[model samples]
Target chain A: MTADRSSGPALAVVGATGAVGSVLLPILSQRADVWGDIRLIASARSAGRVLAVRGEEAEVLALTEDAFEGFGPGDVVIFLTPPEISAQWAPVVTTRGAVAVDQSAAFREDPEVPLVVPEVNAHAVRIRPRGIVAGPDCVTAAMIAAVGALHAEYALADLGVSSYQAASAAGRAGSEALRRQLSLVAGTDLGEKPGDVRRAVGEDTGPFAGPLALNVLPWSGELREGGWSSHELAVRAETRRILELPDLPVAVTCVQVPVLAGHSLTVRARFENRVDAAHAREILEGAPGVVLVDDPAAGEFPTPADAAGTDPAWVGRVRASLDDDHALEFFVCADNLRKGAALNATQISELIAGESA
Target chain B: MTADRSSGPALAVVGATGAVGSVLLPILSQRADVWGDIRLIASARSAGRVLAVRGEEAEVLALTEDAFEGFGPGDVVIFLTPPEISAQWAPVVTTRGAVAVDQSAAFREDPEVPLVVPEVNAHAVRIRPRGIVAGPDCVTAAMIAAVGALHAEYALADLGVSSYQAASAAGRAGSEALRRQLSLVAGTDLGEKPGDVRRAVGEDTGPFAGPLALNVLPWSGELREGGWSSHELAVRAETRRILELPDLPVAVTCVQVPVLAGHSLTVRARFENRVDAAHAREILEGAPGVVLVDDPAAGEFPTPADAAGTDPAWVGRVRASLDDDHALEFFVCADNLRKGAALNATQISELIAGESA
Candidate 1:
């Protein structure tokens, strides 16, 4: 599902008033090469707001170590903050040469960074030794983009996720504490016999210590002691280093529902040989950012309002787990703010502007 | 989770105004025991409404075929409709001899149907052959009440689930289509753009043909032209006829979350021997209606908002899934409106009233 590239780079969106940097500024202003000039930059409490570019508005500014001072090296910089503001503005905008493209977890498992997913391992961004470039965790980029399009067709072993995840990936204040605990269980006062005043308001919340509306918070990020949670070891070490399966065997379980932006998952995977569930639903009905809404009689698959705000990765319940004939069991839905975080940093800034065009 | 009951039978909820007969008439009038006179029935558009007993209010009669007329010959019914209204009210309430209990999926994979689960097959309901005593698809009775209390101290085989399910097990109009598609994505219009006005207001509802508010649907029921989905072969013939593993292989994936009740699962299981995930978390921390709530270094697992409206079955992300020493992974939530449907039909009507006391 490609094509739509109106033109090339010269960007910068850096935390431009948050939330997947305001959805990677109009999906890079709806890819209308609509000619260069982006530079939005934010914080200092979103410097003088105003956004909507190429049609008007624009002016946001602020952010500094001198908003990059001379700055102009911007030919792509993305990083929607936190990992301590992307470990300090990704080496001050890739040491001023630019091409940062992050989405924090502060440069995924570092080893000289390069997590890119311009369609899975966009040639592991020509081995980036820290002009940084990481970006995973949106349930490891929608389960390695449906396991790198099912490792390009049947060949994945040991993966068993269980993510539901949402509350805007714990942002926008955990989606306003799941819209004030589902507006206090839809104004529950169950005492007169509706639910016994919501079961005696048992377990309260303050941006989730529990009770996020109709609840579901299987402890997602930050819990590292041994109960594993840094969003389940960064989705089991980035789906085993982006499916190059360095000894695969991944079993993630990053919960956090009360969704407000879609992230649903329930994968099962497990193969090498007998993959049947009708050839794992014909290799996820011809893979690529998946869409196969499996039909089990007729409760059709894939939903998050059919993958809220498109950018595909919205599969459906594809079965075959009655015990495991090479286990398969699916269900996905993306849009964790567009293909999990500003469309993988604007498709890795279009493969870093197609390798510096 | 027993005692908590008193008196006994005179009960007959029979899908009494649905949704697990309105959480089984306030747990059969506050923690069960209906030993005489209590009927409820449904459908004449939920008859005369009103539901509650110990705390007053009862009237809701409609389901006929001579609505088990003035019961006297063995009064305990239960039924919860479907499988074509329990195959036309289980042989008309077990042929006038009233003993039903059926939760519909017809006679759950009938082998002369026993399918009970009063704590793992109440002596296969003393050989039910026709009195039609069935019940177990509330995710196979909260997953064999957590694998038959961890197969009563470790040793089981081949299993794998992937549910997340909710939307009130598709009833009470699929819990009002997940609370009116989560009030149509919390009352739509989330523009500053991200699924701008819900793909131009697409996703209207009806147990979902569209719109499930802040979404995630992945087929709940229907679909099975040999590609599984009567909620994945009722979790594989009710967990192989209640862990009597008739060729045990059970692979499920019945997801559908908007979180209006609980159901979460993410299992892996696999055994035959090996078993180590800290001795299957000390045999699921000493089983029984199971609880463990795993630790995963401390994000402390199990969720559906901590087993919403709890009644146990809560385990949590245990581990050892990856280098499978007999595989494990974890998580299993519960409360699909009380232990997946009115407290397992009020604990199989207190084990058919302590087996004829």
Candidate 2:
């Protein structure tokens, strides 16, 4: 899918009023000017609402087939909507001769649609035969930049990851639910007894499986076979696909923590070759889209509080496994709304824009 | 190390005013009366305070050699003080002929002293050649009961763990810091930008390496060799010692979360034989110190909120690894104060009391 280069390619953003979209607008205004016209599109309920983009007020367009009438090959439409909406509208926009960069799971596993993280697999974006490119899940997007950097040096063979996912990964409702629950439990001695937090959080769990205030929920997305969550399986599948390791042994446990934004992960990677912490540090320090915050002696490890609005994956706590010299362990944090969602999609859109130019 | 059973063994409690000590007193009073007289002991600063144990107020005695003069061979003194205090006073209490059960890291690595998780290694308490017993760290204590039961069935060969440790793992001050930091950031939009939370929680991290309010600190305990935290190394060491798998390949990452009291762990265990989720559930259900809460279809997995004031290790989210049939993945939660500290120590004291009887 090529865009006409008469002028810079136009960009259409669906779900522009959402959590990720709200973060995307300010980012679009701040980054290099690569778009001719930026269109803000949303559901009927949100249509006509004025949103600021590129320092100008733009009215949100309702989601209809007419919304893509004038879009052409050089234009790009980004979908930050839920999977169902993206699945329904991405093809409509693509059929109108524009490229669709989707941040939904609808077509991520589709072999024809490339799952692109520009830093790790920019080349994958060039071969999107379906005219749609899928963005990786927030959890995968948050860590792949750093993990890809390490894989280039160590030839990763096995992966074990435990996530400390923030509430924002579930979108606006998740974040509001956590804030409301925290407000209900704050200044009270609530967490010391069984079901106290649950009772305090009655029926306001938002989109989560249980109360997320003063708690960590081990489940994310719907339950799958063998008791795995859809989000957990998505992480395993997407990571293998992006890393191009078809048979990598991947085990993941996804957990939802109480943070309002920024997702953190504890990663254990075993490579085919022997690896050490110092060399891993050197690799991460030089990798693009990765920021090394190591130097624990100086209290400089990464945490969600520091990584919440950052663009790069903040990596630290790098160590060689005491039992296996082939294994390295590290901790990583990234703003789930930025690098994990909007930033990666914007980066992919830029890659497509350059191609059309 | 046997206690005298003239009537019932007298129990001496040290660090009576601290976090774990405060929890231990109530537990000792609620459980069966295994002690003839309960003696409260603390530092000179807290010597005059009165605390209730066994439903009676008792005057606290200052820690001095004279305090142990009346303690004899049938007495038990439980030390919940800091490592240095336990290292100093444990031998003194033992010299006076009372069995010392220490909940400090000072003697955990001592070959002469046994690390006892009463449910997993009750027999080890029988041969305390140094007349002192050590309790495992909170992380290890939180999950060992379930892991031990699974090990008995499949024979654990390798282990990997990532902990979602609560603030209380650092003691009362840790909990206070989180509550204070929460109050500072509560009802305010603080976590979205870089350093906003740290700025809001300026210089009051209290026993943590960073701001733990709305954040997950990956560094716990002092930074050790190769970027591993002391708490992380302790989990690996203590798990091996208690499981008696000295050469077991173990990797651990201890992270401090925003939760208050319960410590949760995601564990990956590879065993000698093939393990399945159903069979693992059966074993955990029958395990003495484990409570099975599997059944994710009904929102029935373990969380710190539900396990905070609980006695047993709440085990759930059990699944056999899709890649490695011999490996099983699961989540476990336990109250860091109860089973992780006080309850285990009290259980060991009761074992001694039964010996005298």
> What are the per-model C-alpha RMSD values against the true structure?
19.0, 2.0
TM-score for all predictions? Answer: 0.38, 0.98
lDDT of each: 0.69, 0.91
- Summarize candidate 2's per-residue lDDT along B1-357 as a digit string, tens digits: 233345698888899899999999989878989788788889999998999998899989899886665788869999999999999999898987889999989999988899999889999998889999999999999999999999999999999999999998788898898888888888987788898999999986899988988999988888889989898899999999999999999999989899998999999999999998998999999999999998888999999999998899999999999899999999999999999899999999999889978
What digit string (tens of lDDT, one per residue) describes model 2 on residues A222-326? Answer: 889999988899999999999999888899999999998899999999999999899999999999999999998999999998999889999999999999999
Supply the DockQ value of model 2.
0.86
Candidate 2 error regions (>4 Å) = A1-6, B1-6
In terms of lDDT, model 2 sits at 0.91
**Displacement of the residue B208 alpha carbon in candidate 1, Å:** 28
What lDDT score is found at residue B285 in candidate 1?
73
Q: Residue B161's C-alpha lDDT in candidate 2?
A: 96
Candidate 2 chain B weakest lDDT stretch, 10 residues? B1-10
